[model samples]
Target: MSPSPSSRFRQQLIVAPAVLGLALVAACSNSSSSTGGGGGGSATLAGDCAEYQPYAGHSGTTVTMFASILSPESDSLQQSWAKFSSCTGIKISYEGSNDFESQLPVRVNGGQAPDLAIIPQPGLLAQMVKTGQVKKPDATTVANENKWSPVWKTYGSVDGVFYAAPMSANMKSLVWYSPSAFKKAGYQVPTTWADLMKLSDTIAKSGTNGSKPWCGGIGSGTATGWPATDWLEEVVLGGQGGDVYDQWVSHKIKFSDPQITGAMQTVANWMQNPAWVNGGFGDVKSIATTTFQDAGGPILTGKCWMLQQASFYEAQWPKGTKVGPDGDVYAFHLPAVNPAIPNPVEGGGEFVTAFSDRPEVRAVQDYLSTAAWADSRIKVPNATGWVSANQGVDKSLYTDPIDQLSAAELTDPTATFRFDASDMMPAAVGSGQEWKSLTAWFAEGQSIQQTARDIDSAWPQ
Candidate 1:
């Protein structure tokens, strides 16, 4: 089976599927009480469903959604629509599976497609659109999409026709560190890529609070080398800037081009350096064997001080873990090569698309595209590490400091936000060779030249 991005941003593998059904009860506060589009929501349930009035009149309807998002986040997503389900009498049956990426294609091809799917990769979404199975969005959804950044609409579109709406977003351009450790060590977060390098060197010389400067693992089952890809991506986007990065992704430049190899070398200098990495694990080779899920665990024991990962990593910490500048763990923006380069924050998110165009499904799709739904989703109480690019969302509702930081970076008008390159690239190279070759570079000591050459050769012929 083709590897699905189901494990790209989320690399944790599961033996039993993390499937879930909607409880369908919700209460949350939002500044946008007016449901901007769609029809009325269910009026039968408790709490304020006024904002969901646009989705109303579908009381007897049910819309089944399939996606890669798992347990806790799935719970928040299901709860997000509780009020809508209550007010509109719509039953939103949601199922989550790590195999969603691989299974979605089979389901669609086998004519077992769900009412909707949360496509985490734009490339996969493009494939679904090409199959002629995914339905185009309704006018309301198109209008709601118009409210987002053009970059987002472009991702949800193929050949300039809109088919899906952007869902939740996670920031990848982050370096996670124990805040208390940093403070105790008197190490300030770096503000530029050069400063970041210097900080790494400084920490390698003496370690952080008596622990190694970094901990890393690329293991995500079949997606072993993806974490390294994220490293190279941000380095390219920040070091070479967006235009060059875009050219590389589109194949205007070969994967073996000097620019890309240079980025890979940079990753080696940091992550593969024995002195700087495998802090809590073992030698550099340990990274290949370490699961991304367990890579950051050493930070808790003070064996590893920092790990570069996405904002969603907040959920990786054991329950009751504190996250903030003054808390147990927090993240700082991975800086650009220089202040002159616009911060190119690499991010990942889902596009909500449907296989059937039932009125209720259309209503759900239209509602998802609206800011009201974005607000509702983000307003899931006690849910940490949630961020949305929707301009209409109230950022103040983000009680988690990391969520605030991520949202500020994601929604910043001046920032150059790029979708994950591997997710957007053709799968032959992105999921196959790039992953395989990068892991060799880390585990087998393959040189940047060889890794780049291999991946370049693997690009769809």
Candidate 2:
């Protein structure tokens, strides 16, 4: 089984920034803690600060950040830097708003942009760069980023200038199910798409006591259909591979193109198949109405057996619900569709982009890009549901079982990651028509061809 996604990470990856918050809660606390403040001299800090010497001496400087992450996750983010923040005496103030994407441009154009913002989409970051308001990363920050994979550097860059540091990442190609339920039903985890479908059929026919083999929800307030977009993106990515996936997102091929529509047809067969879905909920239309937050809950009561969601869905399970191979709920990778497709993992992440090039701000950005910070952030006390694309993160630091699972798959050398397509698409489509049209696919029984046409028409010509 695979690990988890933090909708919190997803919100940063997307909410609308969410469909990705479709991402989820982070991991739980269970790691070593030590203190060393002020040049490795005090016992008041959270972790080692030696690598941070060059960034120190900014006492009383406050670097401000703005993003879509809220509450506990936001709080954990603050703590992730507690040691660095303390060592440097640089206060990092944060502002989290549900309306960040809309308000950020307003903030930028008004000369009130944050020192840096955790931009969720490259598309949005590209817009910020176009305004000439967002600053390129400083040398130290860029140097730190150089240590990560070139793919991450590309996401943070526009054209070619590196602007943001890839932050928290979430894997969406995951299927959540109850371990005990599978054990009770005498089943094994499916590794290929054919077997996955077969397992669904096997469970559906074995008598679910009126429940089904799978359950799903596309609901997320205004982001209602974004979850469904994940369904199509994964099909395109896992079944078709990267070149085709890139062409689809860039509009080199239309959504109406068979390559794109073909994926949607796959979604229809799986999710829209009446017998396979709305497992714990009502009929097909209910998916459009059921909140993604509640989609995986039925797995606990044995009302449903499987839910396809990002790793972050771990945060949605009821408290006291154990989440391990031996626990009540656990997730496995969504599984490979074609043996020809090198492990394709569909995922998303936030980027640390700046409007201010102040030394303090860049210091923070540089820290986030470093392996030290990557490990630090994950070790934040009680933090849950987060994965960093940084290859530097120590797999062993992730003691939690789910974190171990997600980190393992994310770091798989053979896995090719395709960022969430809708999140990167032009907002008019990714967050607009594509969303509306996909919702219609479920709610109004819109045909895949028509749905594809509706979304294609919304593409900016």
Candidate 3:
């Protein structure tokens, strides 16, 4: 039996943080204990800022934001609201991502919609637009804030109207390794694709002594093949560059294109080999945590040498593990596959969506766009691994060294920061067909040609 995409997403969600729920609710309640004296007991409207204007005015309204229940990354949104409330006098509430997705359609159909929402799934957002359930965000609202990354703006748009602004971004092109193991083995960090393969080959040939080189796990309950897809995407983007990658994601190019085929071949060659993945590639289908926790295992237990995953993996490292004078884990930029096609980084972002149309909802949005809101809520006491989307906040606010690295990577012009291709695409393609197709390739030993054909056939053409 294989894990389903929904179950995988759920598993990933569970391990991640849902800290936003409590913070959002607290921001809405008019208790001086939480709010303190700021913005005259409310967030100031856009006109008040002079730099930006409020989207709409519902001076005393309360809006509920639907977010992912498993998102620890949402603390930034809560902080934004707290600042919004202090600057303007609006209150905001937030719900889990799944809860909001399930309830949004019902509420919109029932005339009980929230003024705003922040759906993690782009397809759902598109559907809302199709049904006239969402309003296009005013361009001016996000003009000053580079909240909409070029790629996201395209996917989140329908009929040329942008619906949401990207709140925070994730980095996926990171390969974490046990520095100690690498040093002991006399292995140097690979700077190019050829060197990367050579490194993997060396690790594979070397019998597992204290460290295995790869922590490949495709198991996440329902979303079984996602890890495989990540491998495919990273390799393809690194080898083919952004243009070809974009074409495939947008259905402009076939999944079976030579570029994509080569990418899958690379993954198959690496993963199918005996030494590349600990417990063998066969074990990928059964390992839990999507091998996320395992990524740190090689270094932590000295069993594996490296794990390629997003920066979020830093949070999953065993608490109290020591890496050096610093913590136990660290991440390196995914090495460039070719100098021609820069190594593109993969990530996810959160947005604020509205389910209501009151003045307060507008006030909350306006408040969120301010610096004070970003500083207080985002710089939460224990949250060391989060970043704010608002470009105005201080970089020092990001306490986690890994997060700081992710932030730095995001700003590089040579690197293309693309959302997880599967996550950004329509759910039918991303979660349904893509998951099934890729997992079948890995688990059932399906042909690369067949896998690519299957994916193209399943695409929403």
On lDDT, the leading prediction is 1
For model 2, the stretches where C-alpha displacement exceeds 4 angstroms are: 1-51
lDDT of each: 0.77, 0.75, 0.58
lDDT per residue as tens, model 3, 1-461: 10111122233332222223343333333422333222223332333332222422333445666544344434434644453443333456555443344556677788877677656556656667767767655544456356434665655566677766655556778787766666767888787778877888787678455344676666554445666777778887787877887787787877888888988888777766555665332343333334433445555766666777766555556656543313456667777676676557766555555544445554455455445555665466655444554556677777667778877776666676666667666656776678788878766778999998888887765
Which regions of candidate 3 deviate over 4 angstroms?
1-9, 12-62, 69-92, 97-115, 121-123, 138-140, 144-152, 209-211, 221-224, 279-284, 287-295, 322-327, 369-372, 388-390
Candidate 1 regions with alpha-carbon error over 4 angstroms:
1-47, 208-210
lDDT of candidate 3? 0.58
Question: Once model 1 is optimally superposed onto the true structure by TM-score, how far is the C-alpha of residue 100 displaced, in angstroms?
Answer: 2.5
TM-score, per-candidate, Cα-based: 0.89, 0.86, 0.78
lDDT of 2: 0.75
Instruction: Summarize candidate 2's per-residue lDDT along 1-461 as a digit string, tens digits.
Output: 01111123223332211111111112211122322232242222223445566675455567788887765466667777766665556667777765565678889989899897887777677878889988888777777776667887887888888889888788788898888888877899998999998998888788547788889988765556778888888888889899988988899988988888887888888898888878778889999998877888888878789998887677677767888897898888886666689888988788888888777777778887788888987887667677787777787788767777787777677887877887777767876788799999999998888998898898877
Which lDDT tens digits does candidate 1 get at residues 1-461?
11122453344332222122234334522234443223343233234655665566566667888877665566677777676665666677877775566678889999999999988777778789888999998888888876678889998888888888887778889999888988888999988878888888888888755467889988875557778888888888888888888888788888788888888888888888888888778989999999887889999898988898888777678888888888898899999864778877888877899899988899888888787878877787777767888888887788888899999998888898788888787766766688899899999998888888898887776
Give the better candidate number (1 or 2) by TM-score. Answer: 1
Question: Candidate 2: deviation at residue 203, Å?
Answer: 2.0
